[model samples]
Target: MTSMRALGRDRCLQLLASVPVGRVVFSMRALPAIRPVNHLVDGNTVVIRSNLGGALASTATQSGAVVVAYEADTFDLDGHTGWTVVVTGTARLILDADRQARYERLLHPWVDEPMNCVIGIDCDLVTGYELAPA
Candidate 1:
C-alpha cells in the first residue's frame, strides 16, 4: 500500500474542474446520501443543476450546506496509479441572473424535467490524494 499525498487547494480545484462528473453529498433526515451529478466549476464555486425533487434540490432550497466530491483517476488491480479529489463547503441556490445564465450555459441537466434551479457550493475546503506505483 502507498501513502496518500496531500493535495493543495489549487490542485483540488483543478481536478474537480477537469472532471465532468462528481458526487454530491448531503444529509437527509440526519442520514447522509450521495448522488452522482453533473457539475460546472466556476472559479471557487461548483455549480450543478437538478429537477424539482431529490436531496440536492431539497437541500439547496432549504438553505442547507453540502459537501461535493469530484475525483478523476485511473485504477487497476495491477498496481496502477491514480488520484482522488474531495471538496467540502457550503452550498446554496444560485439566484443571480448573470451567474445563473453563465451556469446554465455551461451545465445542462440530463433529465427531461424543467431545470429551473441551480445550486452552487462555495468551496471553502478542498483536499485530494494520489496513488502511484512504487
Candidate 2:
C-alpha cells in the first residue's frame, strides 16, 4: 500500500525554490505540450528565460497570458519515498526591460541559446504530496 501526505502551501513553495529545473505544461496548437526548462522562484512566481522569438515565447506573446502547470519532483527508487509538487497559474511575458533584466540575472538559461524573453508564472495554486510506503 501507499500513503500520501499533503504539504502546506508554504512548504510547497520552499520545495519549488529548492529545485532549479521543472516541466512546464502548456497548450500548443490545441495539444498539450510539456517542456523541461530551468526556472527560478521569485517571491510568488516562477521566472523562465528563453529565446525571445522562439516557440516557447510565442505561447505568452500571442496571448496576453497562458494557463500552465509546472511540476518538479523527486522520488527514491528503492525507498518509494519522495515528494511531487505542481503549480498551476497564468504565464505572462515580462515586457518591462528593467524587470526582465532582473529576472535574467536570476534565471540563467541552461541551453546555449540566446534567451532574451522572460516568462513569469504566478504561483497561484500550489499543491504537493509526499508518497511513501504504507
Candidate 1 lDDT for residue 15: 79
In TM-score terms, which candidate is top?
2
Off by over 4 Å in 1: 64-78
lDDT of candidate 1 over 105-133, digit per residue (tens): 98998767787888888888787887765
Worst 10-residue lDDT window, candidate 1: 66-75
RMSD of each: 2.2, 1.2
lDDT of each: 0.76, 0.88
Model 2 Cα RMSD, Å? 1.2
lDDT of 1 at 83: 74
Look at candidate 1 and tell me the lDDT of residue 32.
77
Give the per-residue lDDT of model 2 (tens digit) for 44-87.
Answer: 89888778676668878888898999999888888889899999
Clashing pairs in 1: none
TM-score of candidate 2 on Cα atoms, chains taken together: 0.94
Itemize residue pairs with steric clashes in candidate 2: none
